[model samples]
Target: MSATATDTKTLLGIALASGGYACFALQDALVKWLVETYEVPQILFMRSLVIVLITGTLAAHFRHPSILTSKYRGTLVLRAALMLFAWLLFYNSAKVMGLAELTTLYFSAPIMVVFLSILFLKEKVGAGRWLACFGGFAGMVIAANPTHSPNLIPALMCIIAGFFWACSTILIRLVSKTETTLTQMWATSLLFGIACAVTFPWIWKTPDLMGWALMIGLGLIATIGQYLLYEGFRHAPASALAPVEYTGLVWAFIYGYLIWADIPASNVFVGAFIIVASSLVLVAWERRSIRLAEKAAPI
Candidate 1:
């Protein structure tokens, strides 16, 4: 393939990945609002239900093959399990944590992705990418000031959720090699819906019209976000796209301030500046590496 084509794909990946995170930020904001009035399982069940219904209906229109016949069924199941586990821990933790702090902790998943890609995908990560990931993490910490967390256990849960999420992300990249986006979406959402359904009845509360609307909206956002993210992995290496996850932190802060009226300290601005700078540096580094590789290739 031509270098121009390769660059275009990478750029598309970055754009999709960044948009996925933005959708997630919106989801987190919505979940934070809903969790105050509803149980986690109930909320997740509703969200998953909507995703499954949408994906299932679209399957025929999109000509998606049977999930049962997928060669990577095992990996898809594992990824769904990991994702369900992560969401449970994360939303439970959301009860006590601020959106800024919650997303800041979860951003650890991207850093984990950079290393996991090396180990699992056998992708060679450059030192510059490593430094940028860490640097972004540090900036997020500075911005979030999680020292103010009202409860330590919930904070820890958020971090653990990040680990599970990181594993799920790697599996997404792995399965993307063979799976259609709709297939993965249907499989994961079906499994997720079933798991949440098992516990949903115990905590079921009939939502008000508003509650129903919000949860449905959450599911719609999640569908778009998941589709974009899966498409992104299809086009770009996980390690190269990992640092772009930091951009979510910026969106989290924006949403936190807008909806919750959580004000940022001066440190927030400083940290955000660092985060942006580091992400830009990583983009530049990736382009340079791609160019050098193209030059070294024989005609």
Candidate 2:
């Protein structure tokens, strides 16, 4: 591709990724609102139902029915469990924490994914990237302000949620090598749907009209957001798209302020800047490593 064409694709990827994150931020706001009146299981069950229907329908229409079949059933189940738990923690934390602060803290997922990649995938990590990981953690602590009694529990929840999310992300990358994206989506929805179904009887609540609207909106928005995320990676290199994910933080801040009147403190911005810079550095380092590897290969 020409340089101009490449730049255009990159811009499109960034836009798609930014739009996806904005959708996710909106979903988070909805989840926070729903959790105020409904149990987490209730919300998850309804939401996962929607995901299953949408993903299943898309898979049947665009691909073969067998695309829903997976050889990595064990991995898919594990990933689904991890994702379910991660969202549970996130939703619970969102109930009491400022959205911007919670999101900034949760944005630690990419940094955590780096460390997890080294541990599980046996990927090499440079010293600089390792340092960036620590810097990101330090930023997380600053943003979380765990010393404050009220913030401690929610901060810890968000941290653990970030770790789980990182693990799930790494699993997705590994599985995506062999599995279709639609298959991955189907598996997550199927497994999580079963998990939610098991708990639904105990926590089920009758939804009023607004509650029903939010529940359906949650599913549609989440599925579209996920599709946009996939489209982003399809259009551009992940390194080029990573920075776009930070747009979620911007959306979180905006949504939080408008919906809940939540104003993030000064430390939140400082910490978010540190975390974002460190993440971008890691992405740059990874991209350089890939280029070096390609050059080193003999034709």
Query: Which prediction has the highest lDDT against the true structure?
Result: 1
Model 1 scores a TM of: 0.93
- TM-scores, all candidates, are 0.93, 0.75
RMSD (Cα, Å) for all candidates, in order, is: 2.0, 4.8
lDDT score at residue 103, model 2, on the 0-100 scale: 61
Clashing pairs in 1: none
Model 2, 2-62: lDDT tens digits are 4445546655765777688889888888888898899998888888889889888877888
Off by over 4 Å in 2: 1-19, 65-69, 93-108, 124-147, 150-158, 230-247, 272-299
Worst 10 residues of 1 by lDDT: 2-11
List lDDT for all candidates, in order: 0.86, 0.73
Please give, for residues 1-299, the per-residue lDDT of candidate 1 as tens digits: 76656766876888899899899889988988898899888888888888888888888688888889989999999999999989999999877787568868888888999889999999888887887888888888888776664578988999989999899888988999888888899889889888877875578889999999999999999999988988998888888788888888788789988988887889899989999888888778767867876787777
- Please give the distance, in angstroms, between residue 285's alpha carbon in candidate 1 and its true position after superposition: 1.5
